[model samples]
Target: MPELPEGKVTQGIAIATAAAFFLLWIAGWLDVASLKGGFIPARVSGLVQVPGAVPVWLTPLSATLVHAGLLHIGFNLLMFVFVGRFVESVIGGGASLILYIVGAYAAALLHWSMDPTSTVPMVGASGAISATFGAYALFFGRDRTRGIGPLSGYAVRVLWLASAWIFVQALIGMAALGGVQVAIFAHIGGFVAGLALARPLLLWRYRKA
Candidate 1:
């Protein structure tokens, strides 16, 4: 098991996110929020119009605040709080927050790429949480890859993990076509962002220390 972070931002985020979903659940406004706050690729792409929907630019973060079901929010929060603590602990709260915000946008971009015409709204924090997962795996997971060609051992490992993650997301994305509403590409993009940015953020954090 890993140690907890000195900061409480991660926990607070988890609580706030969970609370947002629960409040919607209790008030039976889940569908309402989904329509208003959820990320709709079509709307951004100018292919669809839905009244009361948030501005295209804001949907990424707004979508993260809503969820489809109890199990959905439950699993997403579980993954988030678990890896988030360790990642935030090492990276510090400010960096963690920046990572999450970037992850949300990255996730939204990938989700949009997958289907530019999709009007089906995507809601949840899985994409954002996946960024934390990527960082956690990089920061904590044991590495086995050695330096290859001009790539350092760490770079090689990052590519390997990213490739594997993309492959998995591809499978999930293909399987979900015309069926479920999972933002598989969002997960992929967020994870890649995390893996790629973790090192830079860490260096920046400790540069003066």
Candidate 2:
């Protein structure tokens, strides 16, 4: 067996979170935890109330740690292992964690705003991982993009990529929603948040250096 960024804090978080998810599933507690921890737009928007030890308001944040199923967690963790490792390596662990957390909240807020009265609970790390993708794009998009800084060149490419990603996500969400819940808005929100934060993180890293 080989190690994949084994010592990094951001990577550790992803592994630990995935482990916890698996453990919960093995213990038959995943469903119970998800119901209690998953973010529900109606509850978040005050359109409905849920009684629990953990406040409904906190579900948005808590929901990021839960996943709908094995495949869901697997895909999210794979992305986290690859993209998250890169983002964390570039921005440092603390900034990476901040981006993930902020992205989660942003995603939840957007999802709530879009479907304020819906009672469905949203769960998974896709939104947070999407944020990492956004950050990765901003950091590396310039190389792939032709031209220079802001407004033209790499910026245009980034914008196009982001738009295409969102569009695809929207389509997937529409197609999957009837069978399985897909928080498309959450992914968009998180990616936008990551894109927005990427520059600031870079600047901060530079200043620190």
Candidate 3:
């Protein structure tokens, strides 16, 4: 668990995810001017031939890699770097990968169920990252992990930050008041999945002690 090399930290899972997202985005750009890009949507932007028009299974998977812009991917990657590593280390790389996949798909499915006709091409990994937070809560909730640097003491000293996080998401989902349109249901779905899946794992750990 030593700190990974600077060049290789995000190489395997994170880089792959980022690469796939960008590659699809390039293809999308080639298809249309200012109208194309396969990124997941915070809101419903009906322009492309989304998986929504095709099949249900594709919705969740497709949404994870899609992004709205460079900034969008940046934010997702930022979350992935900071929180993803902890979850990955705990669950093991394979299980962490599976969790992200499940979280993304679950979020997308929830979104689709809520708004089937809305044409917004879903994009970004926020939902999946949210899942990481959820799992982190269940896994490390006993001790408040402290934070350093710019955000400093603001982030690290909370025992139930995860609950607060969920509450904020609920508010966002219910109101949609945020200037940017977000798939709030997806966030909820991912959070729920993370908590549910992690519960058994946590319980088993306690039993082993």
Candidate 4:
């Protein structure tokens, strides 16, 4: 493991996320929120527009705060709280938060790039949460890692983990409950960001030391 810094529990993202779910639920506007806040590629590309849709740039962030069902939000928040808190502890609050926000944007771009014309709204935080999961998978794994070709062991590990994760997400996307299609590509984009950024963020944490 990388040497630990004096870590603190920084869980504002997770807390605020849970709060968003609750607040939206109580207001009975989750469905309405989804229609307005969800990241719809067509809306962004100007191929289609909804009158109440939030700004294209902001949809990525807003999308993370809404979900399709109890299972959706529950699973997303569970992974986020678990993975994010650990990453935050080692890298501190700001960097971890950046990981999540960047994850959201990356996810949106990937989803948009893959299906630029789709009018379906992609909602939920699974994509954003995948970033923290990627970091966690990278930093605290077995040391038996070996590189293939020009790739470093760490890079290889990232690729392998990403492949496995993408596969799993593919399955989830296919077998999603109640026909709620999972955003596999979005998850991929965010996970890649986490894998790419985890070490840099770690180095950033102690750069002056």
TM-score of candidate 1 versus the correct structure, residues matched by position: 0.92
Task: Report clash pairs, candidate 2.
Answer: none
The reply for model 2, stretches above 4 Å from the true place, is 1-7, 142-150
Worst 10 residues of 2 by lDDT: 1-10
- List model 4 lDDT by residue over 29-83, tens digit each: 9988888999999998899878877888899999998988788888887777766
Over the full model, what C-alpha lDDT does candidate 4 score relative to the true structure?
Answer: 0.84
Q: Going through the candidates in order, what is the number of backbone clashes in each? A: 0, 0, 13, 0
Error of 2 at 85 (Å): 0.7
Q: Model 1 lDDT vs. the true structure?
A: 0.88
Across residues 1-209, which tens digit of lDDT does each residue of candidate 3 receive? 45732323333656876887678667875223122333333334343353324243454665555666676678778777766676655655556666777788777767767766665565667777777767876666666455666553424443245467768887876775434577777787777677766655545445646
Candidate 1 residue pairs in clash (backbone atoms < 3 Å): none
Q: Candidates 2 and 3: which is better by lDDT?
A: 2
Q: Model 1 Cα displacement at 179 (Å)?
A: 7.8
User: For each candidate, what is the lDDT?
Assistant: 0.88, 0.80, 0.62, 0.84
- Candidate 3 segments exceeding 4 Å error: 1-11, 24-56, 143-163, 170-179, 201-209
Best by lDDT: 1
Candidate 4: stretches off by over 4 Å: 1-10
